[model samples]
Target: MADLLTPGLILAAAATFLFAGLVKGVTGMGLPTFAMAVLGSLVSPAAAAALLIVPSFVTNLWQLLAGPAFAGLARRLWPMMAGIVAGTFAGASLLASGDTGASTAALGATLVAYAAWSLLGRQPRAPARLERWASPIVGLATGLVTGATGVFVVPAVPYLQALDLEKDDLVQALGLSFTVSTLALAGALAVRGAYQVGDLAVSTFAVLPALAGMWLGQEIRRRVSPAAFRRWFLVGLLLLGAEMLLRPLF
Candidate 1:
């Protein structure tokens, strides 16, 4: 922990976590996306992943404990969870084997494309019969992306939106998805012996800033109109997509 306490690094990490949390709290997603984009610029991919683990866990802990929605989410999303677990394992193995730059690039491009689709593409509604299968497919794709790039929302958000869930339920859905993906990614990092005590300590320290940001974002959300929220969400998606696309270039 002391090793990571350098003033400059600590300050930067705190700022990054704060920004990420604000995005997630207001938007109900983007914590991982924002964290990885900013932190990855400063640390190795594995280190960035490790540093996010604890903060992500802390952020989701509130959602998991605050609601009764998990059961309904589970019932509606079991197949998706199964697929995510499987895909997460596959992605983790790839990371554990060695370098994951290629995987990261691929995942980033996929995220950019998906973000575009969500903003502009007309998605077909899931058939009544196919609704049962939607979760698994979404889960698998999200898991793969989560494992490879720590960016899972890109795949999960559209599907959840298409379900026409109430805002609270959608929040719960995202919270659940993030919770599962975080655990899977942690396990994968463990298997690859990528777990670093210092990283976890730093990540834990980051939680203070994250929570603070979330509180502020919630306050901001109260003042924003629904249409404004939608516009900002699109803007955020475009910026994040551009960030992902330009990541490997630097």
Candidate 2:
């Protein structure tokens, strides 16, 4: 635990969380994805996962509850949430077994894959008719990935984005999904003894910088187009993913 508190690591953590909050503040998503990628660069993937708990939970919860659409969104998205819960438990088992290198590598590859999709892939629309079957399927897949790699993107983010929701609803949906993923992940870490009181305390402290960033980012969002920010964000994800993928090679 003491090892995680070194000045360099603390600085790294603060900077990473702040950036994560900013991205989420502006785009309504990407907090965990960005934070984990950057933190995974400086720390073990497992540690990065632990560090994410508090900020992810609080920020996402705020996102989830701040809007008036929670009930409607929950009813519409319950199937996916259910799948996410089940998949997370299954994925966490693998993480708890100490498969650090493979998990982190997988996380990196997953990020790269998603970034590629965001950058170059066509935005496939979710047909209104097929949403019933598709929602849970996407949720399950996302949960599995979250459990295995501590990431909650992939098909989920793109899937939700494709729904063509109102901007506020879309943001709430992201918050809802992220909140579920974070809690499910916390459960997994707890079961495996990877998460502890001390870690929670530290993660809680980390939330301050993240929130500060979010506040600043919200101000920025008022001025900049999200489309532009997302383009650059995807490019960054690509580079980070490549690094993670190739780290074990060299």
Candidate 3:
């Protein structure tokens, strides 16, 4: 923790969170993915995961409550959420084992895949009949990925989109899922002894900048084309992913 708080690192973290929040604001997701991508490159994936807990939980909680369809979404998504917790707990040690190189490469690969999928703008729909069986499987896969990389946007986000939910319901659904993932990830990190007093303090401080960035992003969204912004964002993420993937090899 002491080593991570060097003035340069602190500044880098603040900037990273701010940019992450900006993406989340525009796309209604990407906070964790962007943070993990950038911070995992700067620090270990385990350390970056710890730092994102507070901001991610707080913002996603707000998103969860801001809508009127909480009851229905909760009822529909409980199994998947449960699977997330179970899977995260089951794979909790993947990131905690002090294998930074492997985790960083995993994180890079995830970002690259997700960014490519989003760039293609292909929104595959899951039929209503399949939800009964598909949800838990998706949740488990998502949790395993989250456990390993601290990024929960892979199959989970795509699965959520495939539900063909109404726009607002989809957004609220994402909030619910992310909130659960954050809580589960936090527990996993704690079990692995990644959360220390100094780390918690820095993480807490990051929340403010994240919120501010989100606010700014919302304002920007009102004026700019979200689709355009998202396209560019994915491009940058793809490049970042390439760098992360190649980093250890050199």
Per-residue lDDT value at 72 in model 3? 95
Give per-model TM-scores.
0.85, 0.95, 0.97
Q: Per-residue lDDT tens digits of candidate 3, residues 29-100?
A: 888888988888888999999899889999899889998899999999999999899888776687888899
lDDT of each: 0.73, 0.88, 0.88
User: Tens digits of per-residue lDDT for model 2 on 96-204?
Assistant: 6677678878889989999999899987889889999999899989988888888998778899989998888988898899999999999988988888889988899
| Residue 191 of model 1, lDDT score | 72
Per-residue lDDT tens digits for candidate 1, residues 1-250, read 2353568877888998898777766866667777876665565556677788988987886776566688887888878878777887777655454455654565456556666776678865666577787778888888877777766675777787778777788778778777888888888787778766666766788899999888877887788764566556656656765765676688
Residue 128's lDDT in candidate 1: 58
Prediction 3 TM-score vs. true: 0.97
